[model samples]
Target chain A: MISKKLAATAVLALSALLAAGCGSTKDAARPAAGGAGAEAGRAGVVLPLLTSPFWQAYNNYVPRMAKELGVETLPTVNSNSDPAQQVTDINNLVTQGVKGIVVSPLDSAAIVAGLRQAENKGIPVVAVDVAPESGKVFMIVRANNRAYGEKACKHIGDQVKKGKVVQIQGDLASVNGRERSEAFNQCMKANYPDIKVLEIPAEWKSDVAAAKLDGLLNANPDVKGIYLQAGGVYLAPTLQTLKSKGMLRPAGDDKHIVIVSNDGIPQEFDAIRKGEIDATVSQPADAYARYGLFYVKAAMEGKTFRPGPTDHDSEIVKLPNGLLEDQLAAPLVTKENVDDKALWGNSVK
Target chain B: MRRLRELALVPALVALIVLGAFVNENFLSYANIISILGSSAALAMVVLAESLILITGKIDLSLESVVGIAPALGALVVIPAASAGFGLELPTAVGLALIVVVGALVGAFNGFLVVKLRLNAFIVSLAMLIVLRGLLVGATKGKTLFDMPEPFFALATTTFLGIPISVWLAAAAFGVAGFFLRYHRLGRALYAIGGNPAAARAAGIRVDRVLLGVFVVAGALSGLGGLIQTGYVGAINANQGANMIFMVMAAAVVGGIAMDGGRGTMSGALTGVLLLGVVTNLLTLAQVSSFWIQSIQGAIILVALMIARVTTGRAQE
Candidate 1:
């Protein structure tokens, strides 16, 4: 009887634990206010992707900012990474009488219709991280991806005098990848005429990048430099491959290879300091959240706004062109000042 | 004749190896071979677990989700101490023990639905698959769980006696599964159940009990697979075993395991896994485009199934 009771209690405890586990941090990040408008109480804000650290930080800061502003924010499910899902979420928020909606578009094209739907329902929509191609979005807050790409390529050019350079690109379908690759290619063509850029698609995967690197090495044995756009998660395996082939080294080492990657993830910063990589471009994740919320707030006020440009800070403030662009400036991280915490601290946060 | 039939997969595997060697010299390198086996080990474990269920005339579409969930659960137990929360950091042994217990519980749940509720295995396991996958996504917030214990990582990357730890683990799992299906009365009972459920019942075998046992074994092995996989990749993601069900099923079918069930060996399953791994390795070594890999995998499976079916038909005639 005692054993039976014990087992029953254990099962009860486990079931409770499972139930608790089901409530994700993303759900907890929602605004606590009950209704939509400021007068109606608190409102909910949903993000498109929760898997990425950048998005998670976005989810975290949005609610924290909402709380400080005395507003309620609720995060809805956009887990599918589908524009239809985002559209549905926007419509649902509108039905719930939400004062405003902040969305990071899954597909720039598909979200245009969704934004129009929200607009039709009189719901203000602020685009975050990525902007819709349609001019309907109130504001787009994001890092300057093209400048980031240019800075990354320029850094890589500084490392190698001339030879074959392999560009490890992210998913080409993504707006960030396309813009970054374009900027990198533009910089390469303008400055490094002797350097040959072989764009090898890594698909934003470490193993894939490593495999591609192996093939690239086998095909082009004398490749002197690599420009990686996706940061450490997709760089580790390639770095290991290079290490195995005796290509990576510190300042005094016999062989030196230039690596300029993006998304200054913690490990990438460590790599830069250790000289395994030459430099990296840091995307301000916290700024994405802070500015993303500012855009939502501005939209909610029924203020006239222009889409921001990719090169300058728009935040909630008016821009020079009175247009809000989705891309922001890319901060460069090099071996000379990798220890500067202020520059790369936002990425780790 | 049974022994020869069992060894039939060997020739195809040998032929593939020779073809690979001729196609690419790098395919014969030690590094490439080790990499192939290492990559295949996780999939091999999934196939082994599915083989047990197939032996009992049941299919588990839920094996994929089970693989996804186990590592998430294991990660929860392992990563929290180092990261988010402060708790007693359990060793790999403890983590594995918890994983097995959780797996068995899930298996028993599946068994209960099939036996007591009398749901179709196909429908029941598929539902479980979706439910578990949803739960995994929600629990991890779709982010990967990293920073696993060092020992667990070692289980994936380390070698013992010049053999990868994963290869050894696969071999041991196969040996144990083969022995269970051969010597044990319960194992024999499973085969009887798969061969004919009505006859099994008439022969005084409790079909429900045997099925419950089969599911328990399948789930336990899936748990083991999850543990190995987490160690293999050093992280767990929501889609860790997504699209793996088709691969597991194909490997089993190609290994002479009939779709109708009661017709395969653990040894054949291993050979099927190794054969597929070798083909993939060869393609990679030859610098084949990624787009061709999936099509080639499909073609190999079709050819293997044809050969298996023809050979089986001839023996029956």
Candidate 2:
């Protein structure tokens, strides 16, 4: 009886594992051979991870934008935020004989080995969102993350003017986190001399943001404004905490704490519409996909870019690492332009 | 001696309370106290789960992933495809049940591997953690599920006698588990099994079945923990409960639960969870530099563990 039961349990466990394997592998699996663009040269797109809405939006736009640009691309492989897996994915893509690769690296320093391998294989790479610390790439398509901090600061500063404002920061270890935090602090010091910025480094976790924001509110009940570093994670928790404390007054109310956030997720736009937040810097997800494929396609055809102006109201700058970056336009969206048809968040159903 | 072990973390918690009082006057206020408990609720549940498993000479590192994927899968069933779900649009009640059920299923599978299949528990759980985390990212496609039905958020939003329901639920879980472990016959058998499975089997304690039951229960607890977290955060993101096992393990170890097995109390684990929560809230309220906050948290945990060691008359096993 014991042996029979043990065999049954083993079979059950194996089947369950197989079921989960099937369910999750559908997205990560390489597409079947001879698809619509089999004649066209293929580009491999590797995502850092899909845990955040910003990356998800970019992922959704990749195929559509690729079709529009007539670029044949493989089904994007997600590194799932593992630097080692990212390197492995790059190797796998190279082995598949892709003409070029587009990748958004999770860690700048750790991505070097992957880039080096692709370089050795002579497959050009177009990096999006995160620029690798040391590597060769066809182009880096990203917005000024520091400007994200400054724009948030100006919006909150213009409204709050003098009293204390809490800036819920992301992890200090990350480049985006450090840049946004330092830029926001410097801007506050330069532009609004009297405004006190209370900083809470939340490490990009919503619960941490909510807990820290809650405790901060308890001590500084008079905080006049709030700046959330990443609205994708922080928006709901911050709003819910404020609402629970009965401090989430409408935008025009005297007790309202002016809030500015980053990321252009639909929820942020909805919050702006409901007067829960004042403004957000709409990080251009559509532009990222457009240019990620655009440049990769260009690189595949032997076209090169230089440090200068671009036609899309942006600039291509050469970094200290000798890699060229096309800084895309990331506009600040307020209630006035929250409903703009061109903004990617507005288009998401 | 066991009683002393259970009470070892109390002094550290008390010291933290005193420090919090001095650091910020609002630290002891009723509202701030509730806030601390509310924030610690999810961590407390996962700690409780780990404590149960640790007492059985096992660990479930995948409990952290359970806290993410369970709710993500649960919410996915009720949401439409346009919202990044499978468009099942299942009833909210079924969706909620699915969270705990999925968690229990994962636990059951883990138990099968570690118990019947005789695989190494640590490696099995670690692999499960990676697999479940990947499943969460794939299933959600990296989108945060927002605008869920009101019942989903009601647990964290609603209050009973001025306390969030999640806090109440966590407190009840610790209470019930502590009572059972201390006084119940079957619970004592679990201790015996963890302490020495060979001896436990010789004593006819049904060692394997009890161990399997413990794993399933732990998984269910983890699932409920995720549900409460979903309500607390107001939405489910693919990254929920990411890297939380470190905190859960730290709290369990600091609370005097033995990694080698067969020792510790639910009260000890609960205090461990509270100590971390209090320190985090105090640091934030004190306006400590964001960079120093993590370093300070680590130092405090080390000091607490030292205190536990001294009081227990030995280092934790």
Best by the DockQ measure: 2
User: Worst 10-residue stretch by lDDT in candidate 1 chain A?
Assistant: A24-33
State the TM-score of the second chain for every model: 0.91, 0.98
Which model scores highest in TM-score? 2
**Worst ten-residue run, lDDT, model 2 chain B?**
B308-317
TM-score of chain A of 1: 0.79
True contacts kept of each: 0.11, 0.75
The residue-by-residue lDDT of candidate 1 on A1-349, one tens digit each, is 9999999999999999998888532342333233344463334466776665456656666766776665556765463655678778776776676767777788778777667666665566777767677746667777777888788777778767588888877777788788888898899999989888876665565544554465456445577788888764455555655754456777445567778878766667778878788878877766666666666665565445544333344333444535456555557888777877666443343
For each candidate, give the interface RMSD after superposing the true interface residues on Cα: 4.6, 1.1
Q: List TM-scores for all candidates, in order.
A: 0.77, 0.91
lDDT of each: 0.70, 0.90
**Candidate 2, which segments miss by more than 4 Å at Cα?**
A1-40
Report how far off residue A180 is in candidate 2 (Å).
Answer: 1.0
Query: How many backbone clashes are present in model 2?
Result: 1
